[model samples]
Target: MDWNRTKSIFIVVFLILNIFLYSLYVNRYNEAQSVEVAGEKTIDARLKEDNITYGVLPNSVESATYISGKVHTFTAADFTDPNHQANITDPKEARVILLSPVKLRNVNDDASFTEFVQANIKEGGSYGLWKVNRDERIAIFFQKTNNRMLYYNKSGLLKIQWNADNEVTMYEQTMLDNIEEVEQQESALPPIQVIQALYAKGLLKPDSRIEHMQLGYSTLVYLTQTQVLLPTWEVRVKLSDGEIEEYFVDAVEGKIIEIQEEKQEVEEEDWGV
Candidate 1:
């Protein structure tokens, strides 16, 4: 009937659709590369620099310490490993130590990848399996005290990541041979308490959904021999805009701590203007 009018309307609708699709793509792309942390701009590049590179993060002497029931006394032998490029701080409350990867490699995923990790980690020492992340090629295992899990901030008794070749590319760990002598076990803060604390801190936003939650042990101090870890609650959240974020709560104190992967909670900000 009205051929010219119909043609014009069709063109206008097509242009609107194109614009809408472009906006969606741009939003997702920006969200992937960058995020806001506690109202500050942050990037994956910055976090990765200080986070776990191969298996563990860089450890240094940190003056800051937290109060805990466990304590590790050290002198000078813990940092003497020159072969692994190990770095250790004088034993204190919450200090961490880091070691360079012994034989780092990047490989594709295959059948043997899981087997290598499982076997070597078992061979390294038997601990409770806390988490396994194939995406990042890392497996987390923790030390248990009195049937209660001890959670550290970013580390466990042992953390490992393998490549496609099934070679142990990165391995970082703390000593846990005699945890009882250095510390005592206490009831962990319940999961409900952690969730509430996260909500109070504006972590669980409106329209957000929980992706996963787990309990594990993370290291508080990297001592001469072992790391002292406590119970930790890990909560992964997917925001309304479809971005995944991880929140870590101290299972003992009901407070948030820095994870080795990421330590800051950034606000979702769009910088692609």
Candidate 2:
């Protein structure tokens, strides 16, 4: 006899329960949004407290994929100069000594040096000027693929040595063969996220300045013949003491890449020609 009234009561109770659950969900969503906002503001505040300054952060999101290539083997036909001496014994490299040191129009100008490389070296157009060591009398260039430089890759590098007279006396070169993307494209972490990751890891010091941020590739794996590369964000920082430091962050995975200085040194010594 009271079944109808009991059913009405149950419906009302269930309706009230749904309303309460909806309220809880709405509150949780708002709280999550607030936390995200606070987290971003905290990053800026922390940097400021540490006296760390940075230029404009990159706003655009980018996508990239892993790349792989075999080290190119140089041949005698690659070097045709009769007077200059070329050492292609390594097969993967070419070390050339100019019979006459090529004088630059402007020793201090990068374009002048780049011009010489483009004209004389094989596949030279693919290399970009990286840096010059005055004391060592050498200029280094890193190879580029798809307009992004492969950072400190020995397989795709050009090392030019100059004399006291500022003449390009000799150069060594290596290149990647069949360079191509190897994986599905993935979205790269935004520049700000990468910077925050470095700061969180204590890689960025107090009272420092983030001088520059660039996109590039770094060695992920070195095999017998092929090298695997990962897209990375290169962050350059200026410490409070005025010294510059560089760090690479895995763009897709957000991991800090520890560059192996010892490995690079061994490579240089092993292929010293």
Q: Largest TM-score belongs to which candidate? A: 2
User: Where does candidate 2 have its weakest 10-residue lDDT segment?
Assistant: 262-271
What is candidate 2's local distance difference test score? 0.86
Q: Evaluate model 1: give its TM-score.
A: 0.42
Query: Relative to the unseen true structure, what is the C-alpha lDDT of residue 224 in candidate 2, on a scale of 0 to 100?
Result: 74
Looking at candidate 1, what is the lDDT of residue 175? 34
Q: Give one digit per residue, the lDDT tens place, for model 1 in 1-273.
A: 899999999999999999999999999888865643322223223323433111222232112222233343433454444433332442431122224333333344343433444454322334455555676666655545544445433322456665565446555544344454344555566544555577667666666666666665556665545455555667777776788777777766778877654222111111121
TM-score of each: 0.42, 0.84
Cα lDDT, all candidates: 0.50, 0.86
Q: Report clash pairs, candidate 2.
A: none
Global Cα lDDT for candidate 1: 0.50
Predicted candidate 2 versus true structure: per-residue lDDT over 1-273, tens digit per residue: 799999999999999999999999999999999997898789989999999989987664579899999999888888887756888878987888899888876777889779988887778899998887677777888899988889888888888888888888889888998999999999999887898899889988999999989888999998879999999898899999999998999999999998777236423623355
